[model samples]
Target: MSQSFAIAVVGATGTVGETLVQLLEEREFPVSDLHLLAGRDSQGHSLPFRGKNLRVRAIEDFDFSQVRLVFFAAEASITLEYAPRARAAGCSLIDLSGALPLEQAPRVVPEANADVLDTLSTPYQLASPSAAATALAVVLAPLRSLLTLRRVNVTACLAVSAQGHEGVTELARQTTELLNMRPLEPRFFDRQIAFNLLAQVGVPDDSGHAHSEIRLAAETRQVLGDSGLKVSATCIQAPVFFGDSLSVSLELESVVDLVAVREALEGATGVELVDAGDYPTVVGDAVGQDAVYVGRLRSGLTDDAELNLWIASDNARKGSALNAVQLGELLIKHYL
Candidate 1:
């Protein structure tokens, strides 16, 4: 018989957490026993796993010592509260919340920096990068050899789903109210988000940078293992329901060859290159897919040293749940 281990999925009722449970079943992860946990309000809910419905218990009431591995797909506050408990109980954890610092729980995307895992010891703590950073790193990690990257600029058009179920529900409600000619009152968002794009995803800091932008840049640099890489990230809230779209421009040390860039993206793992004439959209190509769809490959109009492209990916799945599961797989196979 194959060796199996006990695992727990914290925040099991949320979008990413629920998806992580499904992937754990779909991928046939070596799970001997599964525990589902969430906040107080989400308790009593049941999620199906391997043909059985598992009830989600409150995280506050659960014991961390029962599981060997845990996936923290909850909000950052939740992860911050329970992570130390899980760690003290000798549970290896993968966090998708981006709450923990890099020194404590290093950001990791298996496609980009699986080697980072080798340097760590047991009772491992890892972070699945934010959706935008994960997608960007997957496409950019492969191109490091083909180009001497000097700077990376990204405009990430994020879907409402990135804000969790409340954001999605609010978007739907706002759209319906507008179409029905009813008064528009934004609840989850600060302003109207039905047909308009919010320039910034969150409140800006003293430097005029939103938290998401800062996180995207920091996580991208860490995952790609280049601390000195210049990354300017802008996160915009789009009216879409799912998936994230990114417009990327890379400044290189020398002139870039279009053909070589195309070939590199084509061969890169976890990336799909769209045809030159046609482009990929979040709904059409990336909503339910694992690969980051890349299109509109071109160099800068003024500078040949610049390379530009567009990327679309499912933020919840490929960016959050799947990456966490893949990290779990890596931890079990080698580290654990």
Candidate 2:
């Protein structure tokens, strides 16, 4: 028999939040009753669910205890303020904010770290990595079993949508305005992002690497369960609108054949491997696709121990909403 549970999606009106709800319906999750939540401005707005429209409620006024599962897809600031309150109310939390700085809770990419569920005394809490991090982690996870990942260096080309709808709009607006010979006014990013790529995705610290770059290494290591793995990241904000891609170079503990490594990645879940003959691009192949598309597979110039690959995936779907939904399914299967 199927089990039904009350569920809530906070930040229900945003890009990822809407994607999460869409996935819930498409996957036919056992949702008995659904709640939609947002900030005061968005409260009273209507979002479609299960056919009819579900009225959005203010997060401050909603009771968390009414739902068995709660997905925090809201802005990080909003999530930071209310997540603890919801956890205290006794519902399982799947945080997608990536801003969750809790040391106790694991930030998981479900395909990479389903084992995390086993460690949790209860499925009442977990966090998901950002879209870019998820893209990088899922690709590297499968290769891990065949070869011990000693070190990894990633250069991520992130979509403007990483910042949300505003980022996308900002890019479009800037591009159109620029083409018309109008001055581009930037709001969502640090600089003009229509035709240019920004080397740093987020504010840089004293170390020279931006926050997103720093997060990539830390979160990838955490999700891959390799705390000491030497991982370096460089995050670039690309002009594209939806998909995120990564150029990954790995230094492994032992030598691996090209066929063996490609075969390993092909067999990995949530990963789509494209060989040398075929090419995969972010806009052409990865947009609207759930799986991480990996191509440009070959040996790095250094040696047999080094492997290089290019990967792309939908930042909104596979990166945030889909991963959270996958973990939500895991919670339903194991704990709920």
Candidate 3:
């Protein structure tokens, strides 16, 4: 480890990859050199970094030998192919893919489980959860800190942008075509995504939960350090481009007051509490913002210990890239 290290960002042309670059520069990480690696199709593309243009290099040709940190924002297949090479090259790998195991890899959210990165003996680290799950984890962190979370139920309205640029473009294209009275076809999704919401994001598991929902439940429990805590989730794909909104209900062991909840949320890092009478925050309003916006807080009608909340965040930033960058920062500060 070095005070000034060379960093490489794989899948530099994708949505999350681009955001990672932006966050790295915005946070002023000590980058002695920055390398952007993309697929062959995106190799010649140029991206801006700190007011300077950086040409993308094909991942096949990029050398990881001298790189100290590698951010893998590419697909799982790409990660499986290159992650080992990067690790063997002696670089610390931070994976944003779901291909890695949670227990062994220590799936991480900087605001939730940054401590996991401190004792990493392996050359790679798996960033935990998806954008939707990450937002829920952040919102729940404060609540879990105050009381024992007995059960959590979440319904996530996730935007197509979580699928990457293709999903976003398909949503917009289909919307425009529909507005023009053209026939709609499903390409990025199994069904129409324009002006419609689908209750499925991934394949259903044996437990009858979609993969996204399962990941949310499992990752939330992991981040909260309560494996025995019960959780159920329903994941839906909305027409929006970025930001994910979650309606969460929690049954806690102790009663929680609204005032205390508001105070805790307001004081929590990377979170903003919106009081009543304000416009309900939407997905568009949350895009590009790093803070998790929480509002619509209420108590259960029949249960004093139960609480409900609406939480939203830019899935790509707070949920993915920005969080990964923050993890890198934490690793450098505490571990390196």
Candidate 4:
């Protein structure tokens, strides 16, 4: 008989959290019992899984000991508050919030940093990197050996869904009003988001870099296990509703070979490389897909050592929920 275990999904009402539940069912994970939990405001809601609706309960009163594994899919503060409790109850956890310190949680992307899992003991705790980093890592991990990697610069154009349901609603409202020629008022975003791009995703620090940018760089390096690697990241809010698009430039120590790079990417896991002269876009290529789509592979006109590429990925599903579930799968297979 196959062994099954009890599992809990925190923030079960949110976008990523709901997707986590769906993937768990779609992948046929060995979940004997599933607990859907959220804050008081979200309590009483229900989510369907395996042909049944599971009622969401309040996280505060739930006993962590009942579940062997828990997914922290809510905001960072929620994870900060409850993760330790889960840990104290001997429940292994995977955090998607990027709240816990790297030294403590240690980010893990199965494709790039599965080895990191081997270093940890039982009751594993891991972080699923940001959407940008996850996509970058998946595309870059296989290429690390092909090139003498020096620096990577990325401009991530993310969909409004990155901000959660409110951002989605705001975009829809703004777009409808604009189409109807109604007066526009910005709410969720600082300025217009319909048919527009906000250069920054979140508030910028005194250094003028948004928090998302810093997190992208830090998380990418951590997952790649190359702390000293130079990473320049810029996250912009795009008006789109779903996928994330990235423009990546890599500076290598020696001249890059386009043939070798293409072959490497084509053979890489979790990657779908498009043919030359063709490009992948969020709507047509990446949304709702598991693979990270890469195209527009070319070398710098002046700098032979530079390589540039375009990436499209599904941020909500492939990036956040799926990765966290993969971490749970990894834990069950070995560490747990």
For this target, which candidate reaches the highest lDDT against the unseen true structure?
A: 1
Model 2 C-alpha lDDT per residue in residues 181-252, reported as the tens digit of each score:
988778878789888989888789997988888878888889888889998889998999989888888887
lDDT of 4 by residue, 1-336 (tens): 167889999999888998999999998988999999999999779999999999999999999999999999998899999999999999999999999999999988888999998888768888898888999999999998899789999999998988889989999999999999999999999999999989999899999999899999999999888899999999999999998999999999999999999999999999999999999999999998889999999999899999999999999877899989888888887766
Clashing pairs in 3: 108-128
- Write model 3 residue lDDT over 1-336, tens digit each, in one string: 348788999988889999999998888988889999988988679889988999999999878997888998988789888888888898887888766667655678777776666567646566647888788878888766677888888899998888999999999889898999988887878988887889889888887888788788888878877789899789999888888889889988888787888888889888888867563455546787888888888888989898988988898898889888887887666665
TM-score list, all predictions: 0.98, 0.96, 0.94, 0.98
Clash pairs, model 4 backbone? none
How far is each candidate from the true structure, as Cα RMSD in Å?
1.0, 1.4, 1.8, 1.0
For model 3 the local lDDT of residue 20 reads 93
Considering lDDT, where higher is better, how would the candidates rank from best to worst? 1, 4, 2, 3
In angstroms, give how far residue 13 of model 3 lies from its true place. Answer: 0.6
Residue-level error in angstroms, candidate 2, position 318:
0.9
Identify the runs in model 3 with alpha carbons over 4 angstroms from their true place: 122-124
RMSD of 2: 1.4
Instruction: Indicate the worst ten consecutive residues by lDDT in candidate 1.
Output: 1-10
